[model samples]
Target: MARNLDIALLRTFATVADQGSMTRASDILHLTQGAISQQIARLEALVGTALLLRHPRGLRLTPAGERFLGRIRPLIITNDEIWSEIERGDVSGPVRLGLPFDLVDSCFAASLKSYCEAFPKVELTLVCAASPDLLDMVGRGHLDLAVIERAVDSEGGEVLAIDRLVWVGARAGQAHKRSPLPISLVGETCVFRPAVSEALAEEKLASRMVFETGGLDATRIIVKMDLAISAWLASTVPADFDIISEDAGLPPLPSFAITLHRANGARGAIFDELARQLRNAMARPRLAA
Candidate 1:
């Protein structure tokens, strides 16, 4: 008879490898450091070799440990995915989720659709706005949880994707050729507004804000019509849009973190599960890259 590997032990090892610290892995797995150490030891004993080594930095995986983790990582991911699907029906509740307008179509369509289908009883409330507005809405009790984009170094929130900000123009758009640089603005409180302005100022590029709109559709129409150029997270750019190339003399934009924030005192299975879906969705692209 063949010996079976312990999936739980493998999972612990994988998590510790990703986090680089036994203490950090414990926090994520909700196990004490002693428990984490013991589990690692048990796994090493079963494998008949030391798998982890401690250096000044953190836990470094031995060659054997690296090979083990690589082999079992796929198994761990698939196991979790299967469990998520099976448990979906058991999860049903209202979950208020906020997102920037740009993310709804490009990144989250599949994940949100899966969520709605799996948790049929979940009353999902989706609010679309600028990142700052989403945070404000959550604070004012208008929302339960929000996925907001922030400067990469900003504190707080669970960072989902560290997204690249880029200048976007309509395909074959003449807006970039316009003198004084016709820049388009989204919402009044757009978080990217300042970033865009600062980038242009640093480059000493002459620019003018042309059309202002609270509606995303209207802004897209203006942009698609080749009237004004805009900025968007690289991942969220529309299929018909073009990222204004560096040769166009456009200043390089800063990267931002796609972050998740739950309301203060927020605690429930629904909140957690919904947030899990968001995390899973955002992690896919990053993992692929």
Candidate 2:
């Protein structure tokens, strides 16, 4: 006599909302597109309201969908955690984590601390490096999981968030206004370097690399001192810096793909829990904005 919510349908709906497309959700869930649609429809019928709105570009969550997701996401996460703990049976093992150098001080710092506290018996090894290097480590089985940034449209891993790359400079810095814009960069292999260079070249703006380092801290110091302008994700930029825009005569930088790369054959409730926490870490509201 009373309708009951289905976990399967709720999962499908949540995946669609998180991914912004039923197609992507289907891929993640290993379900056919038609099946995904049917699940959504069934869920809607159970709730007696439409949960998704179709748009020309993709899908958007309706008002009801937003409310439903906010309430259910935590429940789903807690449920998963409970299962993981039960299946893990003491959950003691080594987990090698690879992260990009830029994210060390970001929200992930807190996430990592929380994870360590949650699984004190598990040995966690962290290696911070450039994205490409991190990806290689994960692929080679040297790391259990990694968070890397790639071109927005580039495909490969599970995307946690889409980040906007923007030109950054010190507050009140005129370094960007110079005829030959002074720039500082992280490393030769840094993903943002090529994009920044290409964008400047397209705008016919001459630029000089005044400083280059293999570390983010060095780059931060240079940019913070108003020595040079640099490009970084809007989310990762320090609060002390200012984001330069088109108004500053800089070409728009491309969006970046923030993704989770996991080693093959790495399955288990522990690994699943780690991935879930990593997703939560990277999906911070400020980062995704």
Candidate 3:
């Protein structure tokens, strides 16, 4: 039984979701209240699940509805642009963008905001993961483009930025001076791991791996509590954390080249627009000592 979801029904459901009331959705869609209710019922029957709960407080999305909405909201955005916004001179379609976890805090976020404002009709999806994972997605055509990390001249993609790695710690923290210095490290697959660990080894520093994660927030929290010292791109280090000076006895870290990768199969004006934005934002002099 192959069937396509009715865009009309989806638009009705999404309208109600955004408005939070059947009456409000009916007003926007210019349909009678009974017609609105009937459309919602038809959609739920087709999906074989109750997508919403109608109560005195109005419509609240069920768990399934929440999941469905995240997937379909992009569809709705594209659809609305084709029907109503295309003539406005804005391109419309879904673009899957991937990047490493640390780059989110850099100037990339500001460029993303500007891109969205310039092309509101584009359905932009952001996927954050490790550099290797992001590169894999780009290779398999699961992402339109990705920003990844690699050695200075190694092939990850086209180099967009060069970021210096630095030892980070809580302000005035004792973790750096403690015997068997506590340190939080990223996953083994990370490009920085080998360089960071080897740097410490060459210095004969006795350190303990206190935690391992690919997440920025968790690493920041662990380091902020003075539980461990961690390494990060100088640009990604939080304001409160101090980059341990060389006099602090930590070995210097190597620099990583940030690069842009495009899906082999991806092509279109919208994709190019975003790629240009990221390149402009990142391909600048941002190295920190």
- For model 2 the local lDDT of residue 43 reads 86
lDDT of 1 by residue, 209-266 (tens): 8876756777788899999999888988887888889899888999998878888756
Summarize candidate 2's per-residue lDDT along 68-164 as a digit string, tens digits.
9887776666766677667555666888889888876775887788777877777889998889999999888999988899997677787778878
- N/CA/C clash count, model 3: 0
Go through the candidates in order and give each one's C-alpha lDDT.
0.82, 0.82, 0.78
Q: What RMSD does each model have against the real structure?
A: 4.5, 2.8, 17.7
Give candidate 2's error at residue 134 in angstroms.
1.4
User: Which tens-of-lDDT digit does each residue in 23-129 have in candidate 3?
Assistant: 76675467998999999999899889999997776788999998887677667555644543344355678999997888875658877887788788899999988
Residue 289, candidate 3: C-alpha displacement in angstroms: 15
TM-score of each: 0.78, 0.87, 0.66
**What's the distance in Å from true for residue 184, model 2?**
1.3
